[model samples]
Target chain A: MQTVQTIITDLKDKPGALLPILHAVQNSLGYVPPEIVPTIAKALNLSRAEVHGVISFYHYFRDHAPGKKTVRICRAESCLAMGGKALESQIKTKLGIDYHETTEDGNYSLEAVYCLGNCACSPAIQIDNDVYGRVTAESFNEILTEQSA
Target chain B: MSITVYVPCDSSAVSLGANRVANAITQEAEKRGVEINVVRNGSRGMYWLEPMVEVATDNGRIAYGAVKTGDVASLFDANFLNGGTHALNLGLTEEIPYLKKQQRLTFARVGITDPVSVEDYVAHDGYRGLKNALSYSQAEIVKHVSDSGLRGRGGAAFPTGIKWNTVLNTPSEQKYIICNADEGDSGTFSDRMIMEGDPLVLIEGMTIAGLAVGATQGYIYLRIEYPHALEILNAAIANATAANYLGENIQGSGKTFHLEVRQGAGAYVCGEETALMESLEGKRGLVRFKPPLPAISGLFGKPTVVNNVISLASVPVILDKGGEFYRDFGMGRSRGTLPLQLAGNLKHAGLVELAFGATLREVLYDFGGGSATGKPIRAVQVGGPLGSYLPESQFDTPLDYEAFAAIWAVLGHGGIVAFDETVDMAQMAKYSMEFCVEESCGKCTPCRIGSTRGYEVMDEIVNKRDLDKNIPLLRSLCDTMLNGSLCAMGGMTPYPVLSALNHFPEDFGIKAA
Candidate 1:
């Protein structure tokens, strides 16, 4: 298996390469493990503090491994005006987990994102890599059930 | 002749099942042995009509919209290829009143042509600006942009030509042109649309900026949220490079320019130029105090021209047509068209590229067809999350920058998110403060600590705990955040909070005292 250090080394030479390296690491390793920060810092020739700061600053970068599936719901004003809060409540009730929590079954992780830029459709959600808009409570449940099944 | 069919590959369209609709149409066409050319065009900005399928007809392109996979077979059966009549048919795409009435200077070819095809882009008069730009000296190019009265469309409303002249005058061996595509603003998708629908225009615009400022290196700072745009832009860049529109020695001008796309780690503050530069340098996204403006000293401590996607995308037309012709549109200081995004609970939520001075009521009613829920529109948040929430009484305000400023509201990024009567203004106000607390970079105290305090005070007011005291306290905190913050993220957050409090006092459980 290619180590996270190898990934960092390949991308380190490029200009403004840290974010891409972190994204690549998370993409390959599922999450950016805390132990690899020093290696990334070394590869990019920066302090571990700087590397860690970048990781913690952005909401998208994850430090820990996610569940089998990730569900990101839009919590911006457009979605909020379109019943996103109620949809969020419904998800919490159904999954028995709050925002940023994974289901006990190891099947799902719920996250609150600011905006997915689908305000025209409103009430947008992304399950894994696929985005869905105009999502309702019934449709949300159906999607989750299908993914679990 | 093979029928030409267009289905948008725009992310918003894809999110609403444009991809599925495309797939269904393709598969069904194959099944029926029908000869058709499926062109993946960018969105027309009329998002309500998406998965808007356009068929090329002699009478002009006929549009069928809100198409689903299930409807594809029926569409094929109804002979939609011949502009067949159907429940979803909306006649000729150009004749659609929502689209016909507005001026689309920046987004002229957005939904009309295939985004990735350089040939298609050029056919629609795409790279004429860069071609025209190569013939002129850097000073002339700067003069043209300056005379056009073009300002940064990314909310600040700074003159684009002045910014270009600063970079042009600054003696830097290595200057940069950075296109800010962070677009963290809610209810705004014009940037994403331009990037996805007509990426070449953005590329061409950036190229023009490179030539105009004598800058050889450019970077487009994109947000991580826009995965689709990232793909389209990368592909378009490679295509433009291969075609010699990008990279060194463009059209044998002996001038060199290289462009790259850098992904931003989901920070709203990164939308600010200084913060964007910091993030681009692979550092923590923190706003730097300005004295050395980005145009004078920016991006690796060199002169840089940082512009929003719309501002940069609007450049090609300004170059192709004379700057004076482009300047002829709109009223006052706000010269040129603004791509207004009609979102939220509007019945016909979409993109409307109109000149300045169109009344907000016309946008909400004529183009948007009012609230989607058929309820009265109690409030509309013009601009993004940080924009002020205007009451129904303020709906007639003109869309000009100065007009909005006169009423203490900003036409930031021209994003209008309407809300029906069911919206709770107090809750919305609290969310603004809470949003500030969550997204604050912690560089300034007024934004970091003040926002949290504001959130707490809002909670007290909303929960009806010491309403009179907390309301006044909230106002004072908003004032501090408004005056003392380092950037707009902190400074403008009070726009939404105070606007909500002042406009909808009843929702906050306050009877004007």
Candidate 2:
């Protein structure tokens, strides 16, 4: 992990650096640890409450370490209209963990996203950056296997 | 010479397979041993004819739409590069009736310009507003906005000038300008479209706001769902900063306006101004009590001017052409053009930025071309999930803030979602409550607990419970939520529920009293 000093020193002077730092950290180290909030707060001259508030407000910023592969199930209205609930349940059963939880083997992390804007192909899920549309419970296993390897 | 063809790859266009079509065009050109430049531009929001491909020639750009991968070989053979007519003929891209009819002030250069290139943005009247604004006093700029009659496009139609004026009056050493781009509504994708297609316009608009309000920093609270939009914006910001359009001494004017994009967690409540402010400050997106308006004490408790993406996006046009030019376009108090998002079961689901007072029938039948399934139009949910479901009879109602308010309806975000006869109003009404329950922040009592209870009451009434008592109970609960609750999320949740109860009484298996 990059030290807090390095992260702070790099980001502090740049205007609107907090969000960029959060995004960079999340991109580099799967999640933003709570321990680094104070370092960000002190560096940016913001209170820890303020820094912590922003981190928690967005669902994209995860505090906990994700599994090796992360799958974001679409829960947007269009997806929901097309049996996303059943699809979500099926993934949960297969993984043995609920939404926002990681599997025991550290192979999969499941979370819900509002929309991937792939409504035409309804029931979409993004396994990392690649979006798979018209996803089914049966196909999810195949997709997961592909990612796991 | 390399033959250049432009196709849309913005999310909406991509959803329709523009990339596949682009690849096919590239392959066909390659097979012919002809060099090609397939530049992926953004959509003009003529969505029905998506995967729209524009071929550049000496004559200008000619558009062909609904083009498939298989059609590429034929397209290339027809001398499309030389502007020869083909069976997939779309005439001139600008002359398309859907594109021609729209008064796209805020979304002016979206489809026509290259998104990533700063030089292309400048060629199409971009950053002219900031350049024009630098000459005027901040007060003069605020006065110009006051005359434009531009209102917040993010649900509440608050005047932008007054908000800027409030921030201007405040004696603060530091202030901030925040663009609320957390467009969480199911049917509204206009914000995402604007961000992807014309990111520089938004950057320019925010910079103008920053200059006017004496604020040095701006943040666009974009929803996390829009990864593509965020990527486009980040690159656009860096490009702008590199060109001295942003950062210290913008355009060498000695005025600084720096901006950044803040990705929001998938919380619906954060769309509210106060909740959005809380989220910006890095707090849980719970709505705060008013009295301290965001203009007086907002993000980081400094005087802040928070405006919607459309509201700020409209500013550049107002500044350049003068406010009266924009003020002249609309009818009544709802001045200037509105980028109405036509979605759901419509034949033409796209963006139409028209002046206020265009009748709903014109928007539905004329613009939307009726339902996609060729079924009878049952209801159109204007404004989003929280908006009321207007029945067929209300088609005569004009699209204006006052006219909508007359029927207890709001033209929220101008997202008109058409539903066919197949759509069950009861199910949709149930989903409204369910959505509120799912997305509710749980800070207030009526919204937090009431939405869950409302869902149960709705289920009971629809299933087996005594209809007479449950109906009244539902209305009473709606009233409680409308009167109570901190933000519009809970307060406006009852609009869809009540509208369905009033308009589609048959869906509930209850006879009108």
Against the reference, the lDDT scores of all candidates come to 0.91, 0.84
Candidate 1: regions farther than 4 A off: A145-149
Top model by lDDT, which number? Answer: 1
Report the TM-score of candidate 2, chain B only: 0.98
Model 2 spans with C-alpha error above 4 angstroms: A2-25, A29-58, A61-111, A115-127, A130-149, B84-87
Which window of 10 residues has the lowest lDDT sum in candidate 2 chain B? B9-18
Compose the digit string of candidate 2's lDDT tens values, residues A13-61: 7555677678778878888999888888887888999888778756788
For candidate 1, write residues B1-513 as lDDT tens digits.
799999999988988889889999999999999999999999998878899999999999999998989999999989999999899999999999999998989999999999999999999998999898999999998888998899999998999999999899999899999999999999999999999999999999999999999899999999888989999999999999999998978978898889899888778889989999999998888899998898988999999999999999999999999799889999988999999999999999999999888999999999999999999999999989999999999999999999998988999999999999999999999999899988998899999999899889988888999887888898888899899999998899999999998989999998754
Candidate 2, B271-353: lDDT as tens digits: 88888887776567889899799999998889999888889889999989998998998888999999988776677778899
Local lDDT at B457 for model 2: 90
Judge candidate 1 at residue B90 and give its lDDT. 93
Clash number for model 2?
5
